[model samples]
Target: MIGRRILLAAGVLFGAAAFAQAQIDNGLPGPQPLDAGSMILNRTLFEGIMDRNSKVRSASAKPMPAGGYLSYRASSKVRQKVTREYLARAEKAYGKPIAEGLRKTLGAIDFVATWRRLATRDGLRTGDLGDSVTAYWAVNWLVANGKENSAPGQMQALRRQLGPLMASNPGVRRMSEAARQEVAESLMLDTVVLAIGADTAVQKNDPAVLAKLRTTTNDRFKQAFGIDLTTVTLTNRGLAKR
Candidate 1:
């Protein structure tokens, strides 16, 4: 089983990607509902986070330090503690679901690998059309990743290469905009599906977690993408519905 904290934390960061406003508000179907057990897992993990009498809000509340990679290192200790608790709760609540989600996400398409393969086919790199397309895909991927699974070192390299290209070329900027939007939509849909799945797993033992997940997911979507998912109705008046 995946560490509950890692799973929860990852979900909180990347999973929220499902409902992150930027990803969702493009008039997309927000995060899809998870299976029954997954919802329970999401619910329980969140409850445990909130139950602790500490500085952090619930695991689902958006850890202040773990909100993005930029801030992750700043509060490593606190985040680690939360991560442990989150994993613990997840283990007790949902076993396979937690591990499965991690594997799927961690294994999801490798942007860099695909780019390299495609680039070689086109014979392009560094200050060439191929480079431009690569940068385009990369930026879009980073945005979709939305700070989760975002390795600072990898992002730095990508930025070092593409930053100047976009800054120097108006044509490239214009060319990439549409592609970026399309990628954003794809990511949003993916995120929605994951959130729906996780929420479904943990909604039983932890109502508070369920509620926080709904609010955090909704708010992040609104803030990041400007997409609104009205009210999602679960078996009961679960958070996602509203």
Candidate 2:
């Protein structure tokens, strides 16, 4: 009976893998010629990191208020170690720059996961919107730049994979429409930033294109979010110089 049960479980696992591969072969959506193998490997690595973080967080939970702060610190250390190991493996598999982008992208995924957990464990608060916006920005930057140059179809695959993860998190559904709009606008701004950043050669040769992108992004942000991204950019640059 045990042998039969083991065989049944193996078959289920095989079937699931086959179904995922079939999805890749069919090219569900967004970009073409997907690197399914790399996607699978990266997804596995990403999931492992998230799983380790969750486990560490659960293990470090304390009953006392003072112990709670200590537990948070301990969990953070474990998360950092897990992130480093996975990121290093990613860098080895993919080049440094691409891996750096993936680090931000996957980190965004983890952030969303954590937010979702927090919202569920405790009721949603206004502060959650800020965290969600930040995650959306990082994801947008990686996805937009990735679609244009680095690992084109792979980002789409990653995004697709992330959908189910997000859907499973109840907090996402509870977010207000206005907060969601802020997240969307943040993503749009980041997309523009990446497009401008990626065109190093063009920027060096023309210089005008960079100005054009800046103007365009500024206008778009103003129209969409009613905020001045140009001023924000300039202010950030000024601070960096100092």
Worst 10 residues of 1 by lDDT: 63-72
lDDT of 2 at 77: 45
lDDT per model vs. reference: 0.31, 0.31
lDDT of model 1, residue 3: 8
- lDDT per residue as tens, model 1, 146-206: 2123222332233333233333444434434333323322332243233333334253345
lDDT of 1: 0.31
Residue 148, model 2: lDDT of 25
TM-score of each: 0.24, 0.27
TM value for model 2: 0.27
